[model samples]
Target: MKVILVFLLALGINLVFAYLLALGFFYVAEYFFGVCLTVKEVFFLWVFLLVVAPLIKLKFRSEE
Candidate 1:
């Protein structure tokens, strides 16, 4: 039960962090490029990074 509670907490924190990160990215992109992205786009980009980053780490690790 304790482990499950920790896992849930971690997941909630991760989601909030990802959302804020995405919002920051959205504003930065707009500031630099004048291209406005929707919340859906930002959310998808955030999730994509979360999925791809670990794969990239594994690939680099294997190459070493």
Candidate 2:
């Protein structure tokens, strides 16, 4: 039960991080490149990053 709670908390934090990242990316792209990314597209990118972030972290961690 404690493990599950910790997992939930981590997942929530990861999701918020992914969302902020996607929003920032979207804004920068729109400003510099005039690329108009829809919310749906940003959401997709967020989900993709959320899934990939842990793998990336693990890869860097293993090198250290």
Candidate 3:
């Protein structure tokens, strides 16, 4: 039960981070290049970052 709670908490945090990142990316692209990402595109980007970000963090941590 404790493990499940922790997992859920981590998942929630990751989701929020992904969402904020997607929004930032969308705004930056729109402002700088006038490129607008569709909802589907943003969702896919968020999912990709959610999966990859943690692995990247782990890699950097291990190298330290």
**C-alpha RMSD values across all candidates:** 4.0, 1.8, 1.8
Q: Write the per-residue lDDT of candidate 3 for residues 1-64, one digit (tens) a residue.
A: 9999999998888788777877889999999999999989998999998987678668888999
Error at 57, model 2, angstroms: 4.1
| Model 3 worst lDDT run, 10 consecutive residues | 51-60
Q: Can you write out model 1's per-residue Cα lDDT over 1-64, one digit (the tens) per residue?
A: 9999998986676566566667788989999989999878987988975655546557888999
Which residue pairs clash within candidate 2?
none
Clashing pairs for model 3 are none
lDDT tens readout by residue for model 2, 6-63: 9999899878867777888899989999999997898899999898767766888899
What is candidate 1's CA lDDT for residue 64? Answer: 97
TM-score of 3: 0.81
Taken over the whole model, the C-alpha lDDT of each candidate is 0.77, 0.86, 0.86
Q: Considering TM-score, which of the candidate structures 1 and 2 is the better prediction for this target?
A: 2
All candidates in order of lDDT, best leading:
3, 2, 1
Badly placed stretches (over 4 Å) of model 3 are 56-64
